[model samples]
Target: MIANEIKKRVLIALLIILPILMAPVDLFLAPNYWVKSLVKCILFIGLPLILNNHYQWVSIKSMLTVTKKQLSLIALVMIATYGTIIFGYQLLERWFDFSMITVQLESSMAITKNNFWFVFFYIPLVNALVEEWFFRGFGFLTLKKFFSRRWSYFLSAIIFSLYHVAIMAHWFSPLLFTLLVIGLIGVGLFFNYINEKTGTFLTSYMVHAGANFAINTIGLYLFGMI
Candidate 1:
């Protein structure tokens, strides 16, 4: 029993630290978007799969299951998520200078007009799935087994929000950056709640995808692609 407790503690440490460490890679090391994506996949997707093999912390089969009611909730949440994001963007555009995001994406990630479509599709679909699987499936749901509901929710949410800090560094004004981080924490909590209700991260993934859809739509407009 002591051995298992020690192992759980070690796993928790890794779960908390690995993504924090990966933030630097995104911020400083990765030269382009594909490199960043590959590193993220290896760290987020690969590590979780490997750890699950040894620990059995998550049930892949159960996580995939969804009911009709859950599906309806997913749809509603997704629409609301998309609408909320788009509305927020429109409301804040005048004050926030969001066009800087487009400039940063292009200069930092090489996200040009040619590759924007691929990124647009990838962000909302594939990237969101990877995040849901990592933050919700591995981080929150798995940690909930060893921690209290509140701690699990807050730890997972805070880490999820922090993980984006490196990516958004210098992308916004200080006030906007702070606000965005707080908003992310709220979104993380909402995603956790959806996963808790549905017994799966897939529901949260759909909502995340919707949120990404809104962001990428703004990206499209900024790129003058639409």
Candidate 2:
């Protein structure tokens, strides 16, 4: 079973790695959106499908049946947490003399336009669905079986941060590393808390996806980062 989980993780890594490899070639071709679309399908859709096969799909369905109270709590927590992160980042930027992170406002701006349905669809599908399924769903559950809950959360967050480091390998900045770690830690804790509090991973999954959507849209509007 352990070996099987390891194999599953390896598969997830491959899905992530494929996009990284394809990115440059796609950029060269000028039809970069197609490459990203395919990558999102493999990483988000493929990974979740593999995970669902390993676990009973019924559990996921059950988890999604959240109460109104739980939904309200999640919304409150997400807002407070999001606010704290924004304030903290702004403070850190001033304290450390670091530049404010640039948001890719282009995506959100384009998304608001009537012509960008494709980008809008991909945002939810690839970023929220695929990424959350692999990292917060599969990765989080797998670690919990091996370690204490807190440890599992931390480890999973660390791995998530590291996995994302692949994209920033060329930049090599300590501040970026710190931000990535902080971001992943926030995501891990928030998601894990939702799972534990609600007794279902899908509760966390919905929050994760919702938070991602909000952040991407808001970030694009405020900071221009996605």
CA lDDT, every prediction? 0.87, 0.56
- What TM-score does candidate 2 reach? 0.62
Off by over 4 Å in 2: 1-34, 54-58, 93-126, 142-151, 169-172, 205-226
Candidate 1 structure lDDT? 0.87
- Tens digit of per-residue lDDT, candidate 2, span 58-95: 24555446788887887777676557656665665545
lDDT of 1 at 144: 85
* Candidate 1 positional error at 174, Å: 0.4
Clashes of each: 0, 5
Model 1 lDDT per residue over 149-183, tens place: 99999989999999899889879999999999999
The residue ranges of model 1 lying beyond 4 angstroms of the native Cα positions read none
Worst 10 contiguous positions by lDDT, candidate 2: 101-110
RMSD of each: 1.2, 5.5
* Cα lDDT, model 1, residue 97: 82
